[model samples]
Target: MAEVEEVLSHPLNNTDEAIKGTVKLVATPVGTALAYGSLVFMALLPIFYGALRSVRCAKSKNSSDMPETITSRDAARFPLIASCTLFGLYLFFKIFSQEYINLLLSMYFFLLGILALSHTLSPAMNRFFPVNFPNKQYQLLFTQDTGETKEEIVNYEFDTKDMVCLAFSSVVGVWYLLKKHWIANNLFGLAFALNGVELLHLNNVSTGCILLGGLFIYDVFWVFGTNVMVTVAKSFEAPIKLVFPQDLLEHGLEANNFAMLGLGDIVIPGIFIALLLRFDISLKKNTHTYFYTSFFAYIFGLALTIFVMHTFKHAQPALLYLVPACIGFPLLIALVKGEIAEMFRYEESPKEVSGDSNQEKKESEKKEN
Candidate 1:
């Protein structure tokens, strides 16, 4: 994979040259069709499969029978569907503007239209003729067991934070446009002011080491560390219950012999982050938690922006283009976290699993009777 990436990176000596060629290709209608088609297949097909499977799992079985994790399909499918739809629209507009609808445009429209048809039809058909994947022997990652005989587990649901952020950002953008000023430009200006001081210090002959050392810490603690943690959290969301052996769980971390990771710490937090993003915010003062969490996410985003701009100072032009993402990603995260937090009290009592092995136990009997 590394070798392939290297070969692709400088196929004609530099990445810039490759990107320019790709951009020229994109500028043409035929090239746009080909590119969009390739991207759709590569990104969306698996997502569609996963979403289908997840929805199927939800409808067919009880909550206990469902996994506690979101499938990759669910995570990727919605985004891909939106992207493909946008691409199809762009293609339609291109064809409309052309002198004559070319063969490439015809083929692109047909294929995209077919994909849209299947995408729509599948869900409706699935409602009546639901596909099912039966309970298997082994578990997959990102799943949990409530350890109850009659337990029903459902797949993890989407977080509302992402939706709120999208809506809020859209509103803000529109407002700024109407006012003839962008909120993003203010953010960029603030970022520039903060970085300017660092730059002045770096220019001093004595502060060279200070700048390099700061960069090292920033990359290690902020960028790489955050990225790694986020990835691991994602892995924990699979259908398989992640666990450590009894010995390891009980004593390994504190004991001298060896060490192992804790299960709940990872799973709980990951689920929180997921749930945070899945929450939807309505227009009410009570729904303000999303705002706070979104703000928290923005802090990390700010850190990321600083790292990007600082690291690529030589390529300042390129770094400047990423300012929007720097602001967006953080705001998005904050929105989700706030929503999820609102659903629960700040002080939560720990949930307990029933200790009884059978459904006909004393506690169970008391409830049943």
Candidate 2:
């Protein structure tokens, strides 16, 4: 998730200008409520959609398509990596031309956004394909060695439906690249957030805690301790964050007054909530208590962030509000239910699960013999 920053004016066309001071937003109470409410609603959509998709992926037998899971160590190190990346971009803006940097970023995200959007649409697009459509299957394989020693480096399977999806996504990508429209930007942003939550797995509850906890500090420090995060956010023109026009009622579709929320705020806590959904599945209780609790907590936290930001007219670190709510709500539920130990012990590792299944099969065969 990138740092969430609200911008008052259109993105600067010239990068050579000095960093401007924050501009105040003046709007009616109803307009303010509507803008913030819409933001909260938009934020929830991706998290829920992504978490559900992640659960399906986790339960799927095929491991080829599953994204790499994040371990405790990776979670611990994420904040540091993010910090470096944030600070590095800040320095790059200082040393180099912002226009050139943003141009490169736009091109990079243009490609990435196309792929992500295509992937996000793949499942739905498959259903919509005409029955008579020539949906030929395709596989991409890259291997090394020979015969028994051959190692498969990459193996991806797709079909014509996927190609169609990619083509559609590319059109949207072009629109975003050329116009930088908020709706086009959001299409890419939502796809990115959905993919992030769906693919990035936390091994267990503890790892999720480590990640959310670390990011909480990272978001707070970068946002408040220094102006690095805000500076990069203002200069960086990419579809990395979701923006809502605050003055939509007044300016309509051409509105430039925008309120932005970083993808990080959605994806980071989202993975944890998804993990709880998985944990609920593992219990085989047909209940989604933990998942729902955390999901609602995320909404509450984000709403709180907006309220406080509105009241103080300052850029507030969303994670400061989100992290505690997401973690605490579920944890409190677990504690009250006397499932704290069980919650901590629950973990999901594909390799280990497969190995154990294989071992059990072998033992059963031996016993039968």
Candidate 3:
């Protein structure tokens, strides 16, 4: 039990040591509650819708005939690529000096935060401004001194909404950059993560299962099996992780001591939530059973994560609890409904897209014949 406790405490201990005495606990439960609420709001609502729109646009661009959820082949291969990319980034961050890393990360967080926050406002903005505005083409040509070469730039003019969104984002980014306030930092991270979860997509149940299963083991191995994840989580300090105040016991600490849930904890579960939402739409059901069930499961899982963390006095791998809750609850519901097989076999089919692809294929085949 002592050994297990030590493992659980690894993340918090390292983070405390890393931050030094700069922070102390504020109002523990209240702060944490607010943080949890923020995460859920971003995961289920604005952030999610934004992600759906982006995915649809991307798929439409790739092949108008492609399915809304993408193909299983694509879904299955996503994790390997993501894992490799994350590991590589971890290595770079691990090797770089803190000063240099902060410099690079500053720009990245600023730009990404702007995009996330601005995109979140789009739906609301659409209500005030027209969804689609007329486009105007602008051409700019750059000529060398001798007029040897000319390059033309053609682009759509930024209209009322575009300028408003852009202006709003720029102001927010600039304010964060200059202020570097803790609240802004946390909010920026939330926006960026919300956008990420919103934009990510999955093809089907099997894909969500594959993703959650692989990450479940990955989270356990990293948090419990090795020191690497905790170490990385501690050493790296940026808005990529959301910090909630947790040490209310300390005197005069308004927001110093904090509990953190990294973007991974939020996004991994969020993607599954987004998947269920898409699934809800695909079924044409008047109600949203799977989506709501999964959403609540996430709430339960996160609560469990916090409970275990406080109970054990250590850092818990969130995905360890989250994976089972998110995946298991829905499966149980389906089984109870006598729809297990149907759920397992569920695949999104857009017949219009299929017809378009077939037509394209026939046209090419005729030319060949």
lDDT, candidate 1, 1-369, per-residue tens: 000000001011123443222321112334323322332232222222332233333233322223233233333342344334434433554456442433343344333333222332333343443246332233223535654454434333322332333344444334433342322222222222211211111111112222222322332332233332222222221111111122222343331111111121112112222222223222244443433343344234333433443344211111122223323443455466563334432221111112222333556778987
**Best of the two (1, 3) by TM-score:** 3
Q: What is the lDDT of residue 332 in candidate 1?
A: 52
Q: Write the per-residue lDDT of candidate 3 for residues 110-205, one digit (tens) a residue.
A: 887786676666556767765467534333344344532533233233345655776787787887777665566666766756565655556568
Provide the RMSD of all predictions against the true structure, rounded to 1 decimal.
23.2, 4.4, 7.8
Best by lDDT: 2
- Residues 119-151, candidate 2: write the lDDT tens digits: 999998877877899889999899999975977
lDDT values, one for every candidate: 0.28, 0.82, 0.61
Looking at model 2, residue 190 earns an lDDT score of 92
C-alpha TM-scores of all predictions? 0.22, 0.90, 0.72
Off by over 4 Å in 2: 1-23, 353-369
Which structure is stronger by lDDT: 1 or 3? 3
